[model samples]
Target: MGWFLGLGIAGLVVLALSLVFDGVLEGVGGGLDGLLSLPVIAGFVSALGFTGALATGAAGAGAVLATLAGIAAGTLAGWATWSFSRALLRDGAPAPRGEDLTGTSGAVVTAIPAGGYGEVLLHLAGQPVKYAAKAAAPVARGAEVWVESVLSPTSVTVRPVER
Candidate 1:
């Protein structure tokens, strides 16, 4: 095969490897994100490889530059792929309630101080979701609490969250 053709194949292989590792298209709201991710990454990565090959030719160092360029391109591709995969396989996406933390159930990890301080762990999507918890009634460690609402970035108000 011609140099350009071989280069094209190598570039594609790099891109695929990157996508398998990087995760550029994860959780893209599942619509346009799912459809357009591939073509976009492919076009961008191909352009990069083509440019690298051109640079290699101009420098009269085609063989060396081509190998290194393929490696670099593969690296970029891998990063994108990993990122996309992560988005697609998000572990515990925030409950679609937009932080409206009402009636969440968790077990208190520490005694809840009335003034505002504590910790709790609960299951959100089969994952251990821990949040700072506090309540009007003092809660002992291991006590069940209902997350009445989210009070701050790391905290939630609580009551009894009956099983």
Candidate 2:
């Protein structure tokens, strides 16, 4: 009982350390990728120690039975931790790019003189952003426009919307 309790406390300490040194132990398993990450190891140890103590103290189980129960619990905990971490680290859709802004609609924020630059308000990745804009024909401030082409990182060629 005493040893089990001590192990449980030690496991908790390791878990705290894992939080502070996240990703540091990711390479410890060499060829295992992230399967043996700190969080997974910590989950296994904590579950094993705590479950062993519970089994022995509450159920009056012998050492062998307690240890087996602890192993089963620990395996489940470790697998759960691994799965969750992998899901979080998985990549999602590629980020929106400036080229993606082409053909998108916007409004003139400042009047654009023919063949000169002004400002337009457009949505990039669902967020409103201002860009330096140029057009073949003058566009008045607050006029609706369509982005014709992205000229640079911070500028675009636009055309006034007829309607």
Candidate 3:
């Protein structure tokens, strides 16, 4: 009973440290996170080992068997948790809407030759977004332009601003 409580406390401390730091100590590598994270493995294994030992009336020799069982159980649990969390938190970015660009003013990043593609930089959602641009006539670099239409998701048509 005493061993169980001690191990449980130690496991809780390890989990707390892992959460509080949140990989700031990942200089050595990120083995402290993901499915094989040390804190998670330790917490699961220690809790299970304590429970198993108590349930089976495990004594000195039986302690080793209980520990081995705990390790196997912990590994599976950790893997399952990691996989589930990753699926839920998968990388995804919102699509930039086309209507958001039309009529917006931007500056030419590259000189636009007559009927040719150049680049323009516009501020969208407080971030700079660069898109391919075109003009009916030549537009010099750093010249202000107005977005005429969205040519594609990543490109746009623009015209030089008069004076």
Each prediction's whole-model lDDT (CA) = 0.65, 0.90, 0.73
After superposing candidate 1 on the true structure, give the runs of residues whose Cα lies further than 4 Å from its correct spot: 2-5, 16-98, 114-116, 122-129
Ranking by lDDT: 2, 3, 1
Residue 101's lDDT within candidate 3 is: 93
lDDT of 1 by residue, 15-103 (tens): 67756754466456375444335534554456456655665766655666666765576557646754776577687656644165566
Error of 1 at 78 (Å): 18
Q: Pick the candidate with the highest TM-score.
A: 2
The C-alpha local distance difference test score for the whole of candidate 2 amounts to 0.90
Give candidate 3's error at residue 157 in angstroms. 0.8
10 residues in a row with least lDDT, candidate 1: 32-41
Question: Candidate 3 on 31-130: residue-level lDDT in tens?
Answer: 6445555544555755665554564465553666766665666566657656665677685767668668999999999999999999999877668989
* Displacement of the residue 123 alpha carbon in candidate 2, Å: 3.0
RMSD of 2: 3.1
TM-score of every candidate relative to the true structure: 0.45, 0.73, 0.44
Can you give the lDDT of residue 130 in candidate 1?
Answer: 78
Instruction: Choose the strongest candidate by lDDT.
Output: 2
lDDT per residue as tens, model 2, 47-125: 8888999999999998999889888988999899999988887868789899999999999999999989999999999
